[model samples]
Target: MDWMMLGIVLVLVFTVGFVFAPLGLGGGMLFVPILHYIAGWPISGELILTCLMLTGVVSWGSGLVHRREGLMDESIVKIALRGAIP
Candidate 1:
């Protein structure tokens, strides 16, 4: 990818990260589509894995912040993990 495209992708990623972080979302919904269409990347295992990693990081970061603020519910988190883990 060219420098210009890289710049555009970074800007979009930054925007998505800030917008979704507070909502406890990893922004995968936006990232995958943006990467595929804007970056012209093929949708494949690698792309999906990349998005998974990105989302995971965002989740961890946001979760930590919420936990620090005591805004996280332990029981709800466990329930959500049961469905999400598999």
Candidate 2:
């Protein structure tokens, strides 16, 4: 399972997620450089996986925040999702 690789990835992802979550900054910017240079993960698959992971975590975190604030508008989110759907 490449636990070392996965552990490093999870740590980096979650740390970046926690840090950037509040500032509304996404992890895509950091993920590529880190995966390519720091972790030395392959460019092709790493990019796709990192993006998917970031999207999921960031969206979930934001949704939780909005939910807590009572400002999570389902209609708007649904509309955005629909537009994004292929």
Candidate 3:
């Protein structure tokens, strides 16, 4: 719960988002491990929630660009969401 650590995590999340988002890799893969192992953040609800939110925002930003450029596939999204949503 250190503010400095939280700020660091947020910065890293934003950077990862910028780098990997266009490639369709949400930052979660890197975010979780980096936060847990490198940043020494605990594996807990707050960490998980923060990671998910940041990664999702990054993914959504990239997705919006792709969709606007006509590179997005509606059916593919539907299929993925169908499986991901429960």
Candidate 4:
């Protein structure tokens, strides 16, 4: 990647990591669509793979933080899954 592109990516990474992270919004929600709409990245299987890669890391880290804060609930999780799965 060129320097400009690299810099934009770093900015996006830190922007998502710093801003949305505190509110428990993972970076991918902001990153992926920006990549798609602004950066003109293709909406394809590759984007899905990229989203998984980035979001998985953010989500795992967020999970750890939430677990430490004792903010996770099993019953609520089950309830959400019950609705989401169908």
In angstroms, give how far residue 7 of model 3 lies from its true place. Answer: 5.1
RMSD of 2: 3.0
lDDT of 3 by residue, 5-79 (tens): 888876877788899999999878898887897689899999899789878888889999999999988999999
Candidate 4 residue-wise lDDT, 1-86, digit = tens: 56787678768866786766667777777777866865667999998787768777777787788878999997887888788676
lDDT of 1: 0.90
Which of candidates 1 and 3 reaches a greater TM-score? 1
lDDT of each: 0.90, 0.76, 0.86, 0.76
lDDT of 3: 0.86
- State residue 6's C-alpha deviation in candidate 4, in Å: 1.0
The TM-scores, one per candidate, come to: 0.85, 0.69, 0.74, 0.66
Give all candidate RMSDs, comma-separated: 1.6, 3.0, 2.4, 3.1
Instruction: List candidate 4 stretches off by more than 4 Å.
Output: 37-40, 74-86
Tens digit of lDDT per residue, candidate 2, span 55-80?
A: 67886787789779988788888899
Model 3 weakest 10-residue run by lDDT: 5-14
**Candidate no. 2 TM-score:** 0.69
Identify the leading candidate in terms of lDDT. 1
